[model samples]
Target: MTNSTLAQLLDPAITPRLVVKVGSALLVGKDGEPRREWLTALVAELAAARARGQDVIVVSSGAIALGARRLGLAKGGRGSLADAQAAAAVGQIALAGLWAELLAGHGLTAAQVLLTLDDLEERRRWLNVTATLGTLLARGAVPVINENDTVATEEIRFGDNDRLAARVGQAAGASAVLLLSDIDGLYDRDPRLPGATRIPVVRRVTPEIRAMATGGSSSGLGSGGMTSKLQAAEIAGLAGMALAIIDGQPVAPVGEALASGRGTLFMARPRKGARKAWLGGKLRVRGSVHVDEGAAAALARGSSLLAAGVTRVEGSFVRGDAVSVVGPGGDVLGRGLCEYDAGECARLIGRHSREHEEILGYAPRSALVHRDQLVLI
Candidate 1:
């Protein structure tokens, strides 16, 4: 699509947030050196977007590549997981510094954020991640995110930055994710073969589309290929966030390819409040909070669940666990992220908000469940 089409799809007045993913090949060379000029151009695009009153989050991969080189480990990160982690430890500093330096040039502050699979999967940590990212954006800072490779176990690793970027986009409630890749866009067939043609836009990912995506990066620097990009598109689409793949190999300014209609845009599903959809779809209720009739009525009116409204707390769940709110007649009013642990809820049940400090020995946030975190059944 052309820049006008792209702008209409991601109008700042509507879809104000965008997530950009930079692959290892785009940010780091095979010689293990940072591609300063390329990244400098990319950051300029990000700054321009921010100037247009849009939020930009970057999911970047290159630490492991740079770190592997610094540790003199095998090429292509062909080493033990421990060796890879060590390399990540060394390279993450430089990677973070590069982004900070470049963004600083545009008078934009860069916040380094490292995440793992569990951080996004677990409800509490997910809230923290969302809150942090939201705060950074509100304060006009760009978040440069990467996987926590240094400490993330193999079992918890995202495997590629593409999926990581999608998850970040979902968590941040971004309008779209831009995957900067070596290829211009998804092709009907392998581009190396004759008669291959680029697919300009994808409204959905079908089995036929899956057949076209190939795996394994030729550059050997990236863990993700077209297959992973397709996977990312599905993930982002489900979360109501569009995904675009554009070639970042060009020396021209970043976003030039997309502006010139040289990329694939995978459209998102109609958004129904991204966070609430996630909370409603994925959260497993760990406990129950039985509330009085008044509380249930208040919840129906879209007010937060206050301490006085809670009749009893059931199940052994800590603060931040998803809990079903039950009415006096055993009807489930809704479910939400519990603000207090089961033990704390038990102590505060039927008490006034003013008495919470005396009862709990410390002041805690009011409301057993905040309205923003609650979703009606």
Candidate 2:
């Protein structure tokens, strides 16, 4: 967490695109039901980002807090899992309504998008989520996203929205992810303990740095603590998105951190524009495409996923994204972005790339997917 040399200067006031994650602890006041007026200030800051021609997506947590407070459920962390689930169901409605109202005040509409691990774990669904968010950002709409707690099983949880925000930023190709927490930022040690120091920046997450991390919040507002923040940083870094941990309690700390690098900043991955990085660092893979040895060789030799070498297309996938290429015997040989839909891929089985125009009546380009978009697995 404390590699100051690796830290780069940032100004949220000028950063063009960012994913802002507000933890449940930060949004829930003592009275619960979502600290209404506090959200207004956050919205104002977001509006400022929008005015700067930046795309901002918010991954927020507060449903459980609202639900627990509204239904008079216990907040002592002694509640059963069922009780927490019920609280999330009640809190979701309140959280969505509050976000809609607050975002509306700035004349910007807010759209609610809820997902679980499946949304990121399934390749087809993952790309679908990606394209949808990209289109939303293009239209200048702010997306208020959260986990589908009512339906998400415990096994598939991301632990917290910190990681979710990091994934969203990567999927949307966001420039940065701002993790808002109670702490000002990562420190050399747990600041609550004596002799601990506030660490303003981090270049990389060395093991020694991780050793200094603390878990969750003693104040009951935080669950993932600094540990979760580190996890989120790892996710964002893999996607080549800048990561920042900053104070969420302040009115505009997110903006301040973005604009001035006032918090701990994690560098993005080493290489940019390298699709292989994305493929190797993938969160999950749903299905695969089977190719013959010749096709595999062609891919390794910098050729595309031509129809001829494709022995069989496994699993269902939409066009314009990445997929795994298996050998004739089911060995995954490579992964590449596809040009044609799975249905069409099935139709073109074993045909020549030139046959595309003859069969489909219109060619959508030569290879089913280009080599440039493919990565050898």
Candidate 3:
């Protein structure tokens, strides 16, 4: 699709939710200070988005850069992990202050939220984060989110804000994610190459598309490269969220990019409900329940999976664990949280729902997997 066409499709007035990610390179100058003029223009765009009734969330990076400068550390390279952590400790204050000051000038409130990878990985923590963000947006506050760099170790770190923005978009149930970077968009070859060309729109991120990705961030101050952004695109795609990669150096970059679609737009798949998204993207399948043809047909009709339909259960799993639902022909149908353990499922296979209580010594639920917890692939 052409950029202009894509822009028409993603009219801000209709799209209610947006997540904008700004990299360190765009937010911080070579002197290790916030780029005030650029930020002021960006805030104006954010205000305009808010005026159109769009709930905007920002995933911003620049703490380390600012901190390194204040601490008199080397400018270009990420120092030791400890050094980076210290820099983050100091820079985060300056980062938050800059956002607060700039946003307040436009009559907008800024809320600082620091998150680690574990916040998204743990189900309870994830729910809390989502709830907090929702509450903030409901009250007309712009959330300025960043990785909790000071406390994060290598094992728990997201490493780049590209993937972090995608996760934030998914968690916030955003309609789209906008990654503002130094480059304009995805290129067919090395952008510096004479014959290289930009891809305006990506309908699907296939293996071939991934192969086009190159390593290393375009700007020396940032961590994510094109490869990480592509990875982020895949994550957002699976959650049925659109994403755009656009140049951030232009004046009123966010508004201009959306107005002209001057970037690479990744079209979202059909949107799914929150439960379905969690089932499809977050869970680890621990077992499989093979069903007969009749049961598979019933499932297609939106019926729950009863024990009578199950022919066999494979693997060990506890109740409430995610499991695969398979068809008689060995095709995978979907996934759901299993109501029964493996042994219990084995005993109840081919038995009617009425007999579940007698067979299992407890009448927990009629369906082995409730339709509410199931998500068809």
Candidate 4:
């Protein structure tokens, strides 16, 4: 946490892959119309970055706002979930058209991608998204992504696009994520108050730094505030991706912010692999497998956790869910995506891989927690 320059984060050579997020408030005006001029300028910058051989992805949030206007839903008024979904369905078309038209004007193809939280949380779906984004970039098309609000429920929805943008960056193996917002960057206190100063670089999201990210979104069109941005930064940081927050109200915002070093940059942690980082930083653990000392030592030696080494299984979890690997003395060692469900893991406990079929009626993956997926905390 210091006030210093980090303009290099925007360099294509340094950060070849970048994900930029534009909030609904920044993209849609009070009249519920797309801010065409502002978006055109942003698209021009993104096109230039792509022309420079940088993979640029835009995660824009404004479908619901635009849709709500078309549906005659009053601003700031509580609408039924069905009404919101319908609005999103209608708004997506207009949003996509606007992006396609603008990007085409710059001789760049635009790809519309809609995602739900499950799409990123589920392993197979996550891999599919990564592959799709990779293919799009390879084909020279910029992906304009948004959460699938129409199909997303409260349980499966990302409440804010900020966190969704961070996850998108992690899934795409991006080097950096830029959050274009209403504010310049994080401050020590409310910017409205005297003596409040923007902190330039955040090395970590500590409690003190979290305290500084107070206040809700100033624009009523968006749900994310400074707190959401900090949470997004933490997500990007853990995934070995730097995240920058800058005011997007200006023309050529990303370029201006970078040239002046006017935003807060959250430095990334050194990542062994994207999957390892994802495993290590999961917010919740679905279950845990307790292993013996030999298993713990084997894990430390970079070996997989075998079913035979597991002493106990706790909690109900499905395959691919994040599960904790516990040591004999009740110490939680690490976490990984489990290869089998909790019931199957329970039955396989203290059993060798060779005995897996006899116990479970089928032989599955040999390792309960593969070394590649496991990340020691």
For all predictions, the C-alpha RMSD in Å is 9.3, 8.4, 5.3, 4.8
When sorted by TM-score, best at the front, the candidate numbers are 4, 3, 1, 2
**What is the C-alpha local distance difference test score of candidate 1?**
0.84
Point out the worst 10-residue segment of candidate 3 by lDDT.
1-10
Screening candidate 3 with a backbone cut-off below 3 angstroms (N, C-alpha, C), the clashing residue pairs are: none
Give candidate 2's TM-score: 0.70
Every candidate's lDDT: 0.84, 0.75, 0.85, 0.86
Residue-wise C-alpha lDDT for candidate 1, range 1-377, written one tens digit per residue: 22324554346775689999999988998888899888888888888888888899999999998888888889646477888898899999999999999999999999999998888878688889989999998999999999999998877888899988988988888988888898988999888999999998888787789889889776778899999999788778767778888888987435577468788889887665666646543324789999998999999999999999888888999888889899998866677899999999999999999999988898879688999988775
Worst ten-residue run, lDDT, model 2?
1-10
Q: Report the C-alpha lDDT of model 2 over 258-364, residue by residue, as the tens digit.
A: 55555777777654453454554454454577888888778778888888887777777888655778887665665667888888888898998767788888855
- Which candidate tops lDDT? 4
Question: What's the distance in Å from true for residue 1, model 1?
Answer: 13
Model 2 residue pairs with clashes: 11-258, 11-259, 11-260, 12-258, 12-259, 216-225
TM-score of each: 0.72, 0.70, 0.76, 0.80
Clashes of each: 0, 6, 0, 0
lDDT of 3 by residue, 212-248 (tens): 8899886799989999999788767767888889999
Pick the TM-score winner.
4
